[model samples]
Target: MISAKHKLLLGVAMASLLIACSPADTPAAGGRPAPAVKVSTLATEVVQKRVQALGTLLAQESIDISSNVTEKITALHFDDGDSVTKGQLLVTLQQDEEAAQLSSARADLAEQERELARLEGLLASQSAAQTEYDQRQTAKLRAQSKIAEIQALLAERTIRAPFSGVIGLRQLSPGALVSPGTSITTLDDLSVMRLDFQLPSLSIKAIAPGQRIVAHSDALNDDFDATISAVASRVNPIDRSITARALIKNPDQKLKPGMLMLVSITTSEYDAIMAPESALQSVQLQHYLWIMNADQKAERRQVELGIRKPGFVEIRSGVSVGEQLIYEGFASLQAGSTVAPQEG
Candidate 1:
């Protein structure tokens, strides 16, 4: 039913198809097989345990400077950021009127005292009535009282530093009217600093006065030491935490009041089995780790964890020392899969 030319063309086509489908006698491009991946193992070791917390830096002592008397400020001796000694004059009020009153009071007191002395001499000689002598003595007492009142008024006009500290910016200038209890400036002693932090009430048992703490601030390049100075007797009902304070020497005056700092206190110490944080694997709600068994196969183990430190995590249970824990290639691992552990 076929012609000779058609049969010949068909035979050539069939031969070409068979050659294309035939298996290769040699391997395909890139002749070498992929090399096996190597995973490193880690041996657990005992380490000292520690706890960490965050806290703040504060000035040990601070106060607001204010005028106690109502008057126009006549002079200011210190500017913002000036360091002053205790009892140094800070502000002087308009006291010319008070000074004149003091002078008048002194003169009146002198005259009254002379008159009282004459009356006493007369009373002793029986030349003056007792009632008249008593009246003169009362007048002298009133004059002395006036002198004392004027002295007190003069004292009120001067504002002096209560303690040695750095002064804040002045709120009032010379010739400004100031009233009683008007804040003129703020003074703070920065030679020493304080850190206030809150701790869980449960940790109060382990903390005490005089214990050392470490504090860090992003503003500062280095960490500083602080000592526990006080602890609250009662825990805050809302937060269930106890307030604590720490004192730190700030000789350089680097630490300031209300500075936010990270504080850490060691609450306790104990031995714990820990591993690199990278070695931990989480499966659902539980933590796990891949370990190489004696047969050189991957095994999954559940772990109970405790406190986590900088580079390591405390293993409360589920593993022990001398065990080979898989540190890498965790994604490629399956239970019972063979592994080639690389030695360090």
Candidate 2:
């Protein structure tokens, strides 16, 4: 409903306000007071070519504690997750029958021994026949053999640790009958950790025993150094990969068995042109960076990158050593724009 003259006045005021609020172009773009940027020269650094793989942490030695004989558990010597030493008794089965047999065998062997002694004296004095003494000797031997057999049975009934390690969950309680092949628990040597991983056959030539690898545990949020202990002799026919084993020291017992770790293995080493990571800019799939020329102007260059190192990145192409690079304050710059270079 307003008049056309009033509408023209309102439009003119709005235009004036918009112009005042707009940002002005940089003074440096106008050929004075160039923007200052931090700069450094490109340098070469020795870097290792790395291959990544997923590895599983294994115990140095692991085994399931199982029974070899059918017997009732009479004693439980260790609890779940208990640390045990080699030859330590872990379980005791009902051995009363074996014990009674052993005692009876000893008594028979003792009587046989006395009879043999008496017969030996009689044979020496020419009062008894040699055949009688010889038969007594055979009787003593039979009794000794019987005793040994009983002792062997007792030994089998007594379960002992095969190695020093931490025991897993207790599967059988006291009085539980366990037969042959019945699992009682698990034992794992955690003093050292064995990491197993596979790599493609193409990487076989560069790997060998004693080479170093790095394993990172996301659960622990730490990196562990390990040495390759073994490499497979042949490649897997199905996957065309070779398995490698590395040993990591776990004196603190922080690393556990079956942990999934990210592994990094070095294949080769080479020198690379390196630049600060801060200077690189990305546009879609292409990467770009700014460099300072001898004429004190910013020059944008497309660059190829490699793995990132601490505080820097490897440059694969589009850049060379001895060139000055502007790492910071290049956001306000254009190709051929004047810049005040400051050492970074």
**Predicted structure with the largest TM-score when compared to the true one:** 2
Query: What overall lDDT, based on C-alpha atoms, would model 1 receive against the true structure?
Result: 0.80
Worst 10 residues of 2 by lDDT: 22-31
Runs in model 2 deviating more than 4 A are 1-36, 281-288, 302-304, 309-312, 329-334, 342-344
Candidate 2's TM-score reads 0.83
lDDT of 2: 0.91
The residue pairs in collision within model 2 are none
Model 2, range 194-272, lDDT digits (tens) per residue? 9999999998887799998899999999999999999988899999999999999999899999899999988888999
Q: Estimate each model's TM-score.
A: 0.75, 0.83
CA shift of 86, model 2, Å:
1.2
